[model samples]
Target chain A: MKLKDILFVAITAVLFGIVYLGAVYMGAALTGILTPMGLGIYGYEPFYGIWFLAAVFTTYVLQKPGVGIIAEMLAALLEVLMGNFFGPIIFISGFIQGLGSEIGFAVFRYKKYSLQSTMLAATGCTVLSFIWTGIRSQYWTLSPMVVLGIFVIRLASALIICGFGCKLLADGLAKAGVLKGYALGLGQMTLEEE
Target chain B: MEKLNPFLKGVSILVCGLILSFSYSVLLNGGIIAVSLILLLFFSKARLTSLVKILVPAFVAAVSIFFTGMMFTSGSAIAPEAVSKVESLNFEVMSYSMTSVYNAIQLSSRILAFAGLGVLFAMTTDGEEFVKSLMHQCRLKPKYAYGVLAAFHLLPCIREEFAKAQMAFRVRGIPVTPFSMKPVFAMLVNTVHWSEHVAMAMESKGFDGEGARTYYTVTVIRWYDWCFLAVTVSLLVSGTFLLPF
Candidate 1:
């Protein structure tokens, strides 16, 4: 990867790290509020997609082979350094989720930055990370219905936020002319010219 | 513990977490929580108040998980009828068996153990040292490490920009929520703008990401770091097998 690619990934990680930390607090608060309703598990579920944002967002903007993994891992590292409550396990989680996002783009051979590709990346992130959640959170202990509920919510959140949300954000940035040198920017330029 | 190599410390904590995942023994999980706490307090010099701050959310999360586990556990000991009754909220008092309760405790305690390990690493290790250690000990490329470090330092700038954007929005009478994307988009524009300048400036300053470079601070992998790693792994492995509950 070029120096700029590395820098962009790191920057994205740091930027989203702040947002992820906020989401963590939000998840905790929501979990607390929902505990009495027997729905605490679902509290974090809604925001799970936010965790995959760095990976999906980076991959979409960079259109690279491994930027998704690197960005997500870097974001997790930043979270740890920022004193995230979940700690080091998040690093492994980042790797799993990043791989999921990458698989989405890899399916199209990194040629297409279409909505379908980002959604697939988001789906990949949700499914792969769900297994990790199952192991770490012992989701198997929960009733299948509850586990299914969590999965569906998380998948939807990933699809909406990480999938379409990232594409939208990138398009907005590109429109504003800030994405001038990046692959996404060049792609947009070509489309405009054609 | 604070003096240990950051990479080894992270690996040890991660390994211990992985080991804890393979079983549902409460004793092993409790041991991890205790050891991590003790290391944090006495060895790592983490203050009591700060530890409490770190733990309050964890305690809340654990409690929530515990309750959720108790109410919805799919333990085989519980009859399918009881599991089905949970959805209706009309279960008899006998629906919750001892097995479900045990599963709940196991799940909650494991959460605590993972949190403890995370806290131990986050509190003890300095971010810069960890990144430097990654470069010195882990042989991470300077390009990535330095880029990460540079971005890490610019976090305050990002925060400031966020606040500025939020204020700018408010001044224009635009309604904004914390979750609003407008300010976030504004922040991204500036981030993308700054990235180019930052990369160019680094290049101008003789920053060669792929080239060999000397380090001002070197993190050594000492015998005790290995000792810490070995002792941690052994204790966790032995605990997993020997612990009854």
Candidate 2:
């Protein structure tokens, strides 16, 4: 990858790392508030998509095969540097999630950057990472119905925040001319010329 | 602990997590927590306040998880063979029994173990050194490593830009809250623009990832790093096998 590409990915990863940290804090507070209601386990579900943002966004913008994985991994590494409570486990999560995102794009042979692709990418992330979550969080010990409930919520979150949000963010940045020189920006330019 | 190679330290900690993933031994998990806490307190230069800050929340979260696990875990959650081995306690609440209690300990102890390892790594390793070690020992490309470092330095700038964007939103009669996405998008756009400039500037200064370069500070795997890795792995492996449930 080019230096500019690396920089783009790095900057985006770092930026989203901050957002991920905020989500963690928010999730913690929500977990605390909902503990009495016995819904504390689901407190972080809504924000799960945000965790996949760096991967989806970078891959969508860069339109590269491996950018999503690198972006996600870098973001996780940055989170560790920032002293996130989950530590190296986040690193493992990032890898799994990023691989999921890449698989989403890979389904289209890395040819498509459409909404469908992003949605699929998000689903891939959610499903793949859920496997790790299942093992790590002992979801197998929970009733099947509850596990299903958690999966549905997480999948919906990924589809909304990561799938749709990435598309919207990339379009907005392309319009703002910040994405000039990237694949997404070039696509915009080509459309204008056409 | 701080003197250990960052890369080695990370790998050992990751190995510990992986080992924990395979088994549900409370003794093993508790051992990890105790060792991590002791290292954090005595060997590492972590502040007591920071240690408390992590520990208190971790304890609270673990308790919550324990209760949740106890209440939700079904009697037949495990395999039929394993379920038969679990002796149901007389003091049962709903479906909760001794089996659920065991499951709960497994769940919460895993959390505590992960938290301890994570906090230990975060506290002991310097970010710069970690990156340096990645490049030097792990053979991560300098371009990628340095790219991360540069972006790390840009964090404060990005925060300032985020604040500015929030202020601008407020001026435009848009109610800005911590959860608002408008300012975040704006900050991201601005940073993307800055990144292009940064890349161009670096290129102008002959920055190339492909070129061979010399480093001012080098990280080599020392004898003690190997020892640390050996001890950590052996302890985790032996603990997993030898420790009673």
Candidate 3:
């Protein structure tokens, strides 16, 4: 990776760290309000994608190998530093989730930034997340209906938040000319033709 | 709290946390939490009020995890017929569900383990120290390491930058608010500019792209780190054998 790549990843991580901190509070409040209304804990499913979006957004902008995981991991590190409740375990989750996002772009040879590829990456993230929650949190105990509900909600959230939402955000930033030297800003045919 | 090497503390928490995450034994989780609590009492100088602030969410998390985990038991392998078999569990209150109680243990314990470890690490570990240790011990490239640390150190400055941007937005007579997109757009532009400048300045100041670098503050793992690790591992092993759960 180039120096700019490293700097972008770090800068993105720092900025998103604040967002993630606020997200934790907003997520808790949403769960509190919704859980008692028959929504149960799955009410918080929509917010899940925010945790995994940094990787996808960074990768979308940088369009470089390993930037996805590095950006995601650093965001988690900032969370750890800011005294997140998950502590160092955030690092482990970051590595897994980021890789899940990276697999999306990597499958397209890191050459495609289409909506479908972003959605595919997020779909993989939901699957990976489900697997992790299944083994560790004992998701097998939930009613299959609830399990399906969690799956569908998380998947949709990932597509909307990580896929389209992030794409739009990065595009906005690129349009502002902040991302000029980067892959996304140089017009699609500039550096992206590779 | 700050006395411990950040890297050692981080590694210990991750290892102990993994063990906590995987084990099904509630007693073991409780034991680990108790041990961690005592360590905090002895070592951490955190104020009691701040400690409560950290712990309230954890307690809430444990309760929610337990209750939520219970609801999931409906489709588990425990059979729908077994839901009515609260007779074996005995002692029933009004509208009590055995499935929820039974399934709640693993998740509740998991939450306790995570919360305990999280609190201890947060109170004890320093972010800069951890990054410094990574450079010193892991031989991380100075460029990336410093780049990350520099970004971290800029957290306070970022607020000032945001304030400046807000003022600029007002001067431009453009509509802006905290909830508006203007701040985010301005920040994205600002940080990108700063990062490019910093990278260029570092390059001009004789910074190599990627190579070995020297560290002024070497994080030495003290004897206490080993002792802490040994005790945690031992408690983990002993709990596995001793707890019937």
Q: Give the top-scoring candidate (TM-score).
A: 2
Better of 1 and 3 by TM-score: 1
Q: How many backbone clashes does candidate 2 have?
A: 0
Predicted candidate 1 versus true structure: per-residue lDDT over A1-194, tens digit per residue: 87888888888888877877788789999999999877787878888888898988878888888989999888887887778767777889999999998899999999888899999999999999999989988887789998999999999999888888888988999999989889999888999999
TM-score of the second chain, each candidate in turn, equals 0.90, 0.91, 0.82
**Poorest stretch of ten by lDDT in candidate 1 chain A:** A80-89
* lDDT string, candidate 1, B112-165, tens digits: 998998899888888888888888888889988888888888989999999999
Give the TM-score of each candidate.
Answer: 0.95, 0.95, 0.89
> Which CAPRI level is candidate 1?
medium
Candidate 2, residues A1-194, lDDT tens digits: the string is 78888888989988888887788788888778866755567778989999899999999999999998899888987887777777777888999999999999999999999999999999999999999988888787887777888899999999999999999999999999889889999999999999
Residues B1-245, model 2: lDDT tens digits = 88999999988888888888887788988899999999988887999997888777677678777877767786566446544455765433323466787888888898899899889898899999999998988889988888888888899999999999999999999999998889988898889988788889888988888889988999989999999989998999999899998
True interface contacts retained by model 3: 0.56
Residue pair clashes in candidate 1 = none
> Among all windows of ten consecutive residues in candidate 3 chain B, which has the lowest summed lDDT?
B88-97
lDDT of 1 at B39: 84
RMSD (CA, Å), candidate 1 to true, equals 3.3
- Predicted complex 1: DockQ: 0.74
True-vs-predicted CA distance for residue A113, candidate 2, Å: 0.4
